[model samples]
Target: MIYKVFYQPKPEQVPVRENTESFYVEASSEREARKILADKNISIEFVQQISGVFLEYEKQNLNFKVEQG
Candidate 1:
């Protein structure tokens, strides 16, 4: 299954944990994902696995039609 890992860097780093990030990874199970993070030694203040996610539309598709009252 695909797991979306959201994480924040260690507090001591220049970029604090406030600015978080997420990435998709394929793993057999949640435990496996955790192991991967451990092996990589990523100091994360927070972590979560997202079930699903939606991406923004393309630049050209950003425009939308609406009738103003």
Candidate 2:
């Protein structure tokens, strides 16, 4: 199956929009599809398998924070 991944890398840049990209990857299964892109440091927003429904995964939380005591 071919999965189209829409993602924006971490530490996203600037006020301009266009932060995400659509990439097509061929894989055997949904899990495999995710693994393929994971290697590239791409933060997935949505991934829809070509000719099929979107694949779901655990949402990632990567917020930066600072604490003072």
Candidate 3:
């Protein structure tokens, strides 16, 4: 499965709507995805599982690439 991770670069900083960063990770589950990012020290806002129509839409984006952790 693929997950969309929304986060801020620093743990102490608040996420701004326009400044938030995101990436896609391939993991077996949401918990596994969170665990994979634990060492990065970023402030995680959301970990969403992507599939079906939404996954297809994301695939159309040029920047959509899943990171292998």
Candidate 4:
């Protein structure tokens, strides 16, 4: 199964990238993904676990969109 990992930087002062990112791995769960990110020392402001592959789209000054495949 594919999971779309939604992440925002921990610092609100930092600008977010236009497109949300997805990382593919054979992990069993969403928590595992979070753990992996944590072990890598990547700080996240927010995250969501989504089903299937997704296309990223951006809306200015609003939440990013993840379109599931």
Candidate 5:
């Protein structure tokens, strides 16, 4: 099962000179993913299991279309 991990710094934690992105990761299992994050010294504040995947599409709107279909 895939999981979404949210990492937030602790109130009393000291700053580290590392670049940790505030995002999520998908893994085979929650426990494995947590271990990976811990190995990187990242504290996971929250973890949510994702039931399935989602897709999104986007397009830009322009004025000069010349009677676009």
Candidate 6:
């Protein structure tokens, strides 16, 4: 499955609208996805599972790229 992970790049910084960034990751589950990113120095905001129409729509975006853990 694919998950859209929203996070702040700096661990010490609080997440703000403009400062937050997102990426797509392939993982078996949300917990697994979090675990995969555990070592990265980033503050996670949310891990959302996306599929169907939502996934298709995201794929159309120019910035859409899935990161491999």
lDDT of 3 by residue, 1-69 (tens): 999999988789777867788999999999999999999989999999999999999999999999988
Q: Model 2: clashing residue pairs?
A: none
lDDT of 2 by residue, 1-69 (tens): 556667777635532247775666677776877776666765678777655323222112132121111
- What's the ranking of the predictions by lDDT, best on top? 6, 3, 2, 1, 5, 4
- Tens digits of per-residue lDDT, candidate 6, 1-69, equal 999999989879867979989999999999999999999889999999999999999999999999887
Report the lDDT tens digits of candidate 5 across residue range 1-69.
545555646524654435332444556677766766775555666666555332111012232111101
Candidate lDDT scores, in order, read 0.49, 0.57, 0.93, 0.45, 0.48, 0.93
Residues forming the 10-long window of minimal summed lDDT in candidate 3: 10-19
- The C-alpha local distance difference test score for the whole of candidate 6 amounts to 0.93
Q: lDDT at 29 for candidate 1?
A: 72
Instruction: Report how far residue 34 has shifted in candidate 3, in Å.
Output: 0.3
Q: List candidate 5 stretches off by more than 4 Å.
A: 9-21, 53-69
Candidate with better lDDT, 1 vs 2: 2
Worst 10 residues of 4 by lDDT: 52-61
Against the correct fold, how does model 1 do in TM-score? 0.50
Q: Stretches of candidate 4 above 4 Å error?
A: 9-19, 41-69
Candidate 6: residue 17 Cα off by (Å):
1.7
> What are the per-model C-alpha RMSD values against the true structure?
11.9, 14.5, 1.0, 8.2, 12.9, 0.9
User: Candidate 3 local accuracy as lDDT?
Assistant: 0.93
* lDDT winner between candidates 5 and 6: 6
TM-score of 5: 0.47
- At residue 44, what lDDT does model 1 achieve? 52
- Residue 7 of model 3 has an lDDT of 93
